[model samples]
Target: MSASRTERLLNLLIALLNTKYGLRRSELRQKVYHDTTSSEVAFGRMFERDKGELRAYGFDVETVTDKGWGSDDPATTRYRIGKESNRLPDVSLTPAECTVLILAAQLWEQAALGSAARNAVRKLQAAGGLVDPELPPGVQPRIRPAGQAFEDLVDAIHSQHPVTFSYLAGSTGQEEERTVEPWGLGSRFGQWYLVGHDRARSDKRFFRLSRFTSAVVVLEHQTFAPPSSFNVREQLAALPELPVRYAVVDVAAGALLGLRKHARAGGDADDTGAATPVPDCVDRLRVPYRDAETLAEELASYGPKAVVVAPPALHAAVRRRLAAAAAFAAAPFPPIDFPRSGPAKRTRKRTSEDQLKRMLQLVPFLVHNQGLHISEVAQRFGITRKELEDDLRILICSGLPEGYPDDLLDIRWDDDHVYIIQDLDLNRPVRFTVDEACALLTGLEALNGLPGLAEGGALESVTLKLMAAAGEEGLKAAAVAGPDVAPEDSAVLETAREAIRGGAQLRLSYLAPQRDAVSDRDVDPHRLYSLDSTWYLEAYCHSAQGLRNFRLDRIQSLQPNGRPVSSAVDPAGGFPVKLFTPNDDDAVVVLELTRQGAGLADDYYAERTAALPGGNHLAEVRFGSADWLPMFVAQHGGSVRILQPANLADATREWLDAALARYEDSTARQLD
Candidate 1:
């Protein structure tokens, strides 16, 4: 009544034409008009008038009143707009978003970190109407290049077109001739690099397109063999953070390097071979691997030569192995377990109704394969259609990522029923593999044996289901469930789950190993988080006057203490977790070591090594935290030297002093 309903009909018809099917008059009336029942006669008159008007605008509205084509369903009478060859409607993304998406596509086309970048690229393509649904968020590219070369290269690579270009290799003012078979593209070290087979060398090589002169595709045909079974991400991630040798690689030097020259893995050479002085053909060791064992071995080979850069875990592992080798040939034996201590111990979150409630609570999303019918889902789960549909509805709405841009509810609906939009087979459900099932079942069995968990049989059922899904082979892994971790001493964790449920405060004596102290703290427990097989109470901690991660394994004692937290507390803001606590005095303990030390620097729990010297071709590792200092020191076993910071130096010296004191006292006693 307010606007021209006739014009609106034509517009709707135009939009509908893009889909595979079309609606008849009554269906159109039902979809577009709020009260279509009353407009039945008017709707019919408008439909014919609209068809005539649209035909004038060059829309071919073919009528189907003839013989076999006549609709028996009666919904085919409405005129359908022929496909629009002129233009498509504008998409939902802003220009800025579109630009980002295009760039993401550029990155996607050249990505070696395939899975990691897949979603972002997919989402970008989705925004560009290239892909469907969307991908989740991920770590932003640390290397943000402000050039269009990356984009252009992606197009050329994807199109499989040939491009002529010149690239400056080094300071010799020499330009090499190269025609390449583009394999992939990737970003590294704040610049973009392309991986392709060098036509000149008959080998795979990397080219920095930004450095190439007159790089443009002149070839029209796109035909080339893509590299088989090669992952770009793995190759690129293998690059060293910093070079031990010169960043530049001469033919002889590169050939001598032990690290394999992956198409795009490294930016500089290592100095592992640099110390030879006489300079045999090459001047560096090969790439330091990410695998803990391989990295340990590599670091050991370097002994004191290679420098490790990037990622804390790898560095720690190398340092750990080196320290262990220095201290002892074998790992220290585990602490002795006391005889069947107290009564039975229960699982932290092992409950039936609780698990069901959680499942229900988290059900709204996670359904991606949309083609599954409700009946099929019911059959697969051996449940009634009602229950299955309810589960599906929950999955249709359930997920994290606040508000739900990433929510997996792609259900398409007509006036009568709902249909999930899936391109693949809907009958198949996402399931765990044999190994994964085994791991899950093992965890489930461990949970079953835990104290308090015996009261709930849900975990057992889940385990059975997982095993059944994986079949007999999976049961073997589950059967191999081994010894459980002993409960931590000096900390008795009592989860305040009931307290949070019933609105009560908990009194706790938490062990603070940093200060070698255990203090009484009052907490209003809200939640319990299970991470890496340990429970932690996430609640309002009154001891620190804030929230804290109270390790369930580390609770020395627990009792009822205070009332529920209610004083205008922010639900979102709470105590930030420090990875580890410090001991008595803060120590700026600097560790001086070889390139292996540089590699090991990544494994630190605290801040970075200050004054990192490339000059020495070694790493100066520093630590200032007290948390787990003794344990960390013990693990390292003394290949590392404490450079400065008086207190930590004293601590190191004190360890040596105590060892010396033990030896002297033992000798005296023996001599006497």
Candidate 2:
């Protein structure tokens, strides 16, 4: 069989590392490119490309020439990666430190950096520097990078490559093509932004990831150097605050109470030069807003119940979004196959890049854990024994250009125990990638704000240790990124933590948004966790007689009732993978999600899903109460539409129609 590029690269890496005086172009061609290349030009191109690939993987391949004879020739140029430069430096970490690091690494959740953080922790484990320590129960903090654009920009920044994308200009509200030398990505004011040098404008620009209108295209085979002292946080901090504006909206008297609470009870005159009279069963509100786009989305979610009365721009924006949503919801869709088992588990294809990354980490791991059982190694790397064996086979044939038995890596599995007899200079873990470092550091910083976690200055100590080990450049690059987590009310959060630690039954005044009512309930606190910056307490509600997740912000008043807890529920076992837990009695609602709303399938814990034409999907989801369905439909605009459970769909359509009719009546009055 022909050797794959991954195998060839591994062979080349092995050959380059094993050399003392470095290997010349001709020697590398003979050793690494013998079977792959047909001519000298092909060999040269392949070798150069491989060198860059290795460098991209964090290996610094040094170039040298023999000037000892006082005769410098371009042909004498040789290349090799020094062990000292490529290997990670030794750093001592306590069990507590390792535990904190693990927690930090696990914070990426579903972002692209999640895998990188895991890989970083695995390397630490392989080196025997990590220890398993008990984490705070139910406290899983996660940060999700905005989307595909964030991942692409991170990669581009790491490779120092330029990127091109279509960006929606905030001022003009039009999408324009932009080519930028991506310097760093950071989060500020609950949004992620890319700080880069705009090629067309010839100046530094900070772009919000949310404003991106198209997929980011990384210009490979081209690179540019960013400013030496560039820092993402500093750049973002220097940004000017946007001027705040006000919008007048007319909402139903009893509905949308949350919106009403934040707004004042008066409105300005309408565009027709007359005082806007509040319609019967409606309340006019003057709401302060900074971003029109954000406000439009929020208002559109109210569906037909809320209408902008003043500021033509705001009204037009809200109307446009609602019109789009109503059009999409009213559109006919193909019937979906329902009442199926569930969404089929997706199988990810193992790519060559993935294998290469695994092998690079595997070498140092096996070196540290000699004579480990073969199965254990496979399990650790999340691969099968056969795959591990194939990787071993490839490595065994890879070595120095000498082509001697001693030059190759020695391996044996005589008793189902794998051992690496020789690993050359690849016996130490590689340095952390930029993404991995940023994920860990940012997570650690976030942990500092969480009350119960990181006691005894462990978070700070760990941060110092990591910064010292990561060096200046790594630290600088990592600083280009930050996590955006909203600060929870400290007094309320501390009170909740105290209750959970003390194992007490708590009496609480909680506002249920779905029901739009505040009710007092007795509950035993189980665990406290946050998802997407919103803190939720999973508790055994005496009233509900089941596990219920209550948002911390909605707790009108929380104080322990000074009673011992009676619920014998296991706190560790009940932590949900998602916020909502489906019950048999819950209503099953089928939804058709546009490409924009596909993420809702995962967010809502869809039981079954099937892809439709044009990137739309049919999802079967469970709703504990159908009362919130109309608001859910409106909140997401046209992206989410009810397709099944005719009664619920009809109710939602009726609600939208009523809201739209109110707006039309108001428009007719204005025309008159």
Candidate 3:
């Protein structure tokens, strides 16, 4: 049965138990499936199935048959799951089994595992086992799943129903409609995939959840019986493996640390397994990859730091993307338009899964750490105090069904500390699920590849222990494919990290690309963050006498400044300075835009658009520097015109003339 239907059944059971007499079929249907009322025969069948499932799951559903019991009715049947049969007896789980349950719950932190993990946790809790859902600090792994489609598909799978949706196949990059009977779902390499018998294709196929482009609608009255011999893992293993080829690449020193695990395995190795270290700041390494295009994209992102030395296809793919990028820079582009006609939609609230996770973690936390400051708990859970309070309010009424005052969770707070009156016996930390363990192992491997962590470091040891726990199947389930940090860049990152950690300053030889120069500066390193595969350091520059953001790649050298950060400069006081912001040095220019160019109003000047006659628009555009204004206007290809600041317009015209002359001259040269 579907999880929703099972939930309804449980609610019906509770309602039946709450009454002195069993509820008739009509009463049960009205009370339980109120929103989904159906035909009499359909309701009877569903109710009967629900009762049978309850019995199968160890609940005794009692049926009272009445033969005109002092009334004018011919016959009547009423049903109830008695409390003695419905309520779970004492659950005595071993510590190891409890740990497994905890680990299973913790698996939900990853997006792909979240919904199923949450359902599992709730079921366990409902079964009267209070589970501690929190894992040890520093064990979190970043994992993103297939979002809403995953949850919907999980429901379809559980109900043995067919689901219809549009799926975008990666191989073709085209969306096609499909109806499938979902047999199972699995995660591999941090990606969720659904396996099912495709109705259109008449064959079982695997679909990546990420490819789902439309809502998964479960067929109302259609269901299928899964084969008794069906094995999800077996099917996944039987899926065809793509052809793999080895590529020999020249890697820069200290870069490609993540690939060192495959070190000396295939290349530059003698009879002994020791790797031959090629010198001259470049190492010849053999790397195996299945997808050439993917590998090319990854290698190209590294730019000059790494080069593909052999296998012409891989190199060509990288060069192709680079050439396309160059062509785009010299080409005129279409204006981007965003739809803005509809009324603003309400922001979605956190999912019930998120609420359940927080509650599961929050309860045990409060139970173990009684009298903890409410503010501290909120901070610990990475939620606002108001959100924390809202969760508490929700929990106040949550407990066993037919919720009596004694059955509900007892929560008490005195504006400062929070206390839980009842102990749920869920105070142990969650262990790691196989997939989660694999994900964390992958992260730890990347960390261990770094020089700072390679030499018997804590992270390295953790990696070893986790590998031991993961066993063979877990190791094969996921992989870590992170960017290769050049040794120099890694060292710079480490230095900045230490400065941030120790509250010290850093002396950096930084390259300013826009200024076409390199300069020395002392900066109080604040934090390090990665975006678009590039690491940046946010710091207070002593030379600039202001906060500045420095790309780690642009830092030629970095060293400690031998002084602690000043107390006056709070490391966390300021917000991130945007790359483009209104400043005293910037110019506010008015632009007259055609319909095509005006479409960009929301993007460029959402708050400064004014409609003009003849379907034109006037936008107030701010420029940090007018150096690129001419090129930017040229890129718009006459869709825009400068309306104010005559000097700026005249300068832009001259720049355009110069650019035209250069292009004309280049064309003439080519012709000659």
Candidate 4:
């Protein structure tokens, strides 16, 4: 047997990383372990072991084909250590920067995003610059998406392997065995979905993670090639588009601006190029929409500020839903508590091949939650007791350079309780993967958006400190040039954050999107959150007399009302307003891009884009609203042609004509 697989693995890594392109199998054997190549069979076995070991340590050995750039043949494939993935830039984080990173990590605790965040923090700690035994207090906000199927689905998606899982079909409401070639995984509207090619039905399908009734079983023997043009976002855009229809509605003054802000919901100005004045403080206007349900919900949120007039169907639907809600509230019903049934499934044990980060995470958790029962700890970590025990054994055997008894981790445990009795320095901080670093960086960016922090100067300063720690190579991999936050928006965010912290009420001139009007309302700012690249203030509004979510961008003006707030709501209590959910049934509209827009092929929805000759491109952009398609086309500045859904082309022309009239009117006024 070889003396140490670790020594050989390190030698192999050095050889691979040093190479420019990659080494062939023969070249790898000759360079790394000359004795193994004495026989072809022995070399093959050694190479396989080394490759598997590398992958286990988080290195993906990418393969390149000999048949030129576009060839799909695996037989001609040669392997190389992916340069970007193979290296981890040395980071030296300042204490303040480490604190910021810690806060960022805490933000996603117990979240689907937590896995990446925790691992990144673990790596940062492993780098040995700033150290904290536990996360700081008062920074625990989690957005946890519950599911066990997500991991299995992700695994299948990565391996490009077909998986069989019993899914609770939405249409039938029964569990059915589905064999799908997993293509991509995405999250929208706070739910995870697996978009894949269903082999059983010979069609692409979206499987919600919550719908899985059984564990996803990856079929090891079956593998499939994903289409080159497959894009998860494009596939999700299949929902039905709303048909174009104009509805006459009456709204309060200044509400039109609010409505226009969400022009995607069909904001149309009247012939006067302004809102139509109506009776009783309401201004009449024509709004276009495809989705009656969503439009109704938006209008209802405005309370009595807006009224749906024409389009009897939409008016009736809104009235009916509102009436039913009132009736339900007026009626009394007994609360029934349903008992949970079925025994819990046994947890799967982890093998040595699993990433060691999980073990690192377990250490801190166990240390903090000391005296917890063994079973309790296992449940907390989402692992079986046997698996936890195995991790414990592994930790006990791991230590510093000498590999002696005192240098190793002193883990004390019994069947009932587990505890760590020695110094916490035994566990070397794990290096952050690129994705992990990006997640943490994005989180820091989110925190940086908030104002009213006294301890830290600006979030930007903290980010700079982190970037310095991450080194040059790390920045190249993780840095993103995101859209700049508007100065006014940032000011509003700061003021609102202060109001929330001080428990003070604010008099804010806010645009209610549903009402299509601006109104001054006294609000007790509760908390601030960002979604879809926009900051939102969740506050208790005194005007509508309810809790509402307000976009910071729509806030015209904000002033301190001077009155102390009566109550503060939990930051995570409000409903997550989904901006959009692409339905799998939406009509796909293909657009032929001119040379001007051809370069944007990569920027467009991935699954819907295809390259053509002469630097032209065709994209099947998703549109569920009659209003969205025309606007999308107009925004392209005449560089695109709507090829499918002939009706869309006509709609685009109508929108263009309307725009031209507005511009003509503006020019005439200027001349006068």
Candidate 5:
């Protein structure tokens, strides 16, 4: 019987680790390969692949060859992993430091780094270097890497692979293909950017993730060495801010108050002379803008309520977006293949590589937690009891080349409790992977911006200790990306936390964008949590008689009433995983999403989704209020289209058509 790949790799790792003088290729093949049917050439190929895999897993497989006779001959080379080089050194951290580290590691909410951070923290816990501590109330901070492109770029940067993507150039307003040797990725000015060597231009450049028009494709077969001192944060910081420009617009009275607040009356002869005629209730104003595309998106969202009069470029951009939205709204819905069994539950496939990584960490964890229940061990590793048992069976059969009873890993279970009698020098945790280090370090830095999370310089002390443990490579990888939270929001965040801690209700003057008004409301403080860079307060609203989420930035004023909370509702367990809390009264709307906008389904927490042709999706989403449905459709340009609910589809089409019609006369004049 042929041995499974997991068993083969385990045997190979054991053989290599136990060797003192390093074993020759022929000897390693003879010792590790249980299947005798394979040819010598095939065994050689498999051995080479296994060696590379081990190296990738952070093992330093050293090659040793005799100098006297065939020093340069591949046949004479022997391989072994140095124990001192491969093992993680002891890390001693204080309880306070452990608390801060745990928060830092959990900062990546749903990004690729989130899992990496969890694994890193688990390893630290296994090594007895981390003590689980209670988190601060009403102070949860999270950073989300934009999308799949952000994740793909991170992987490319780690592997030093070049990537190709279509990017819309903000400067030229053109879409172009770019092949870049990804150096680092970081968030700056509330946007994620990739700093890399552009192969076409043969110069370093920064590309914004939001500007990417296509999926990132990594050229794994090709790789390059980035400069050792390359830092993502520094490169992003050096980027010059875009020169701000102004747009003249006519906004209807009592409409788009958010826009009017940042705008001033436009009366200059040059600006007003070029302005198109507006109704008596409309006010002409000049609004400062940095990026025309970004401003255009915002203006398009207002539908016919706001019109860009001057800055022909901005006006034209807005008109184009509105026209596209209107065209999509009026178009026929695509055929959708709904699943009869309902939406498929998300499942993660456990590959051999995943299992091997888990086993490596599992050994050290079991060493620290002796006689733990088998079910508990399986739960900790996010696997089933049967899976854990299978792993244990495989481990017991793996050992040194001699395969003696004592030489193998001794795993015993009694009364549903599991214990590792011998770990074969794997009791110590392995060093952090690059992604794990980056996730943790970036998260810690983000927490630095939040007020009063850690005190007595514990945060800084922990950061320094982690840097030392991460080594040079880990530091370089971590430097590629970071998260930034606006420090200005700290005051409001502190106030909300205070209210929650004091068990007092808060009287808040909050801006309701949908209603275009600022209203005062009293609410019992629940919790303060942040998703990405935005902080939200989940509270029980007295006005609405239910739970509501208020943006900290939009909170005009907050004063704690000093009265004890009256609500009987407990805010402990119902913390939302998504920004929107679906209510029974929420309108169930169906929509179609283009390939570019398919991520919106996940963002909005769609109730059901069906696959359509051309990379589009049919989603059934719940809207708290459908008042903003038109804006949502227009804001996404033509990427989103309202499908079902005949009234909504017609309303969105009419809204977009009216917005586009406002530019008709100006467009005609230009053509003449």
Candidate 6:
């Protein structure tokens, strides 16, 4: 960095300390830039340079000492900026982009702490010296992980090795030996589990981490060794996240699906001549953005086109997730009398009626274009290059969960001047297609139907997209936006969330399906969560007197009427599947199969059976999941089942029984 830039970096630190954390000079350097080692050889005068740069950037830092206490300690010096920090970034952003960054920081704050998150608080805190850093008091503890074990598992997933731990069965109270070569870890509802090959058991398995006594890295530095012929996600995505489809997606000609798709390699059926041509129907079709939200959005896209043809087991799983998600979203929430409208007045006085030109001038870049320069951004913004280095510091701090989560303001200033990352047509209007409006309405409607307590969350995300599609008028349009709301139900959920966080006891009306009656009770709501699109309050139900599932849809009303308790709340657990599939005689129900499903059966699930009976038409298969028998059958489509007992057949029949009933019920309703 140049001498001037270096000096500005120091001043930036001083301004940061004075405004945000209230740091004193000598102590501030020790916290961030100072070397902790006692050795002096590697030291530099970072502190002195920082002080000199602060003055040059037009920041006046005053040093003060309180004279009293012990006479010896009277000689202390602390820094407080004259009138906030002068270090702002030179780059510019439209008010909307700046708004998104702020919302992202707020919405993503907690996720950033997750090991899976690429951005984090410590990172933002280090660079956002000139921008505002405080989150509104109401928005603490952003989005809570459904469970902590899932969080820890996600943290460990980016590694290659066998996870060692003691796992106990919830009912049997028996612990077993397990050494799993983890492939991937995923979360559902409120728990986390790992999918990998287990050398100890000689099979592929899914084990929940929350049920373990201890979780540790027993070994490290293992080869990723994805089976030369498999697709992992397609195999594991059997339930909640997406529909496991069988229609042959056109794999590139001559390209083999990665073998790692199987847990480990089920059999020699991982094959060739039987390979079919990649169909032209889906030949590199357009896919939506590959961001996290895309995964959730899939539920809407794959609704009826992707059918679970044969295995009754897979069918139930899909229905349950959707029904559960729908049931959850359509449920009731705690009541609140949210005001009928938004803020009645702007926080600031209306400066002028000059329209677009005036709003553009308010943009940081346009207001200060003279001093903006690529190299001198540090000097003009009064921030260190590193602070304003990556993204615009002004935009970095602009989100509000305190308001709607997605309200966006594109504020950018770059190169020590106001420069936007992308141009937004503030001068033009936005028009939406009928389909886009339908999609937008559908998403908003989903929010409107959410568990009463969390209904607002869904709407907030919808409003954000709407504003983005609304074009030029933006905030001016937000002022006129309206949809009548019955605030009573939503009020309850908010109060419940508040009580849960504040440690307050709640009085509520709960309906239990098993009993089919609503009862009044007092309980402690430990956490609030949404899974499969429905909202739920996880708590120690004093009525059940144990950790129980209370659907938000069934909740009638609620309020914080009791004191917060001091006890800790245990995290949610996963649904267990007791079945297995192995690659050899050692497993149950062996079958010769097509080369298609071999990688999944052999490699990951360890259910690979022996070689094809004739090495010409089929491959072998084995797997274990007592509940999955029918679902497994459905997934294989028309594939042959070599070992079928009266029980497995009866199981498939049973699922059809339930499904046919549901189908019949729909028909009856339509006829009415």
lDDT leader: 5
Best-first order by TM-score: 5, 2, 3, 4, 1, 6
Candidate 5 lowest-lDDT run of ten: 341-350
| lDDT of prediction 3 | 0.55
Which model, 1 or 3, shows the larger TM-score? 3
RMSD of each: 22.7, 4.4, 12.8, 17.4, 3.5, 25.1
* Most TM-score-accurate candidate: 5
Q: Candidate 4's error at 121, in angstroms?
A: 1.7
In model 4, what lDDT does residue 278 have?
A: 45
Q: Model 3 off-target regions past 4 Å?
A: 1-349, 372-387, 402-404, 414-416, 423-439, 464-480, 484-507, 524-537, 557-567, 573-672
lDDT of 6 at 504: 84
> lDDT score, residue 196, model 4?
80
The positional error of residue 534 in candidate 6, measured at the CA in angstroms, is 7.6
Candidate 6 per-residue lDDT, tens place, 526-556, comes to: 6554422335666666765655445566787
What TM-score, over all chains together, does every model reach? 0.32, 0.84, 0.45, 0.43, 0.89, 0.27
**Each candidate: what lDDT?**
0.41, 0.75, 0.55, 0.55, 0.80, 0.38
Q: Which whole-number lDDT from 0 to 100 does residue 515 have in model 1?
A: 51
lDDT of 4 by residue, 1-672 (tens): 232444455446545544566667766665556564267777677778778877866667776667555434333556766555533445566565666666665544433345666566655544455465333221222233333455465556655678988886756545799999987665443345688889889998887765565567889888888776555545555633446766666666655576555443323343334543345555566677765544655554343445565554555444543443333222332222222431122113334434254664566555555678889777755567877787787666554323357655678886478888753332233345544654565567545443333256535665665555445323432222112122335677778767866777899997754344678989887766554235677777787565677778889999898899875444443223222224565566666655444433323332355545644456666553544454344434334556566676665555445444433443354345
Over 237-291, each residue of candidate 1 has an lDDT whose tens digit, in order, gives 5655543322212123333133333223443323342221212443433343423
lDDT of 4 at 232: 59
lDDT of 2 by residue, 1-672 (tens): 134888888888887777778888777776776745377676667677888889978788988877773223537788888877656667678877876787777767656576777777777766666777677655666665355567778889877999999887887777799999998888776678899999999998889876665668899989999887777877888988778877888877877766776788877566455786667887878898877767877887777668888777667666656665677778886778753553331113578878888888898889878889999999878678989998888888777666779888888888999999988667778777776677778777766666655567788888887776666535655545656444367687677777888888899988887776779999998777666467788888999987888888888899999997788764446223357766789999989987556656656667788878766778888999998788788766677889789888888888777766666776787677
RMSD in Å for model 4:
17.4
Q: For model 5, how big is the CA root-mean-square deviation?
A: 3.5
Candidate 5 overall lDDT versus native: 0.80
State the weakest 10-residue window (summed lDDT) of model 6: 477-486
| TM-score, model 2 to reference | 0.84
Query: How well does model 2 score by local distance difference test?
Result: 0.75
Residue 563 in candidate 5, Cα distance off native in Å = 1.1
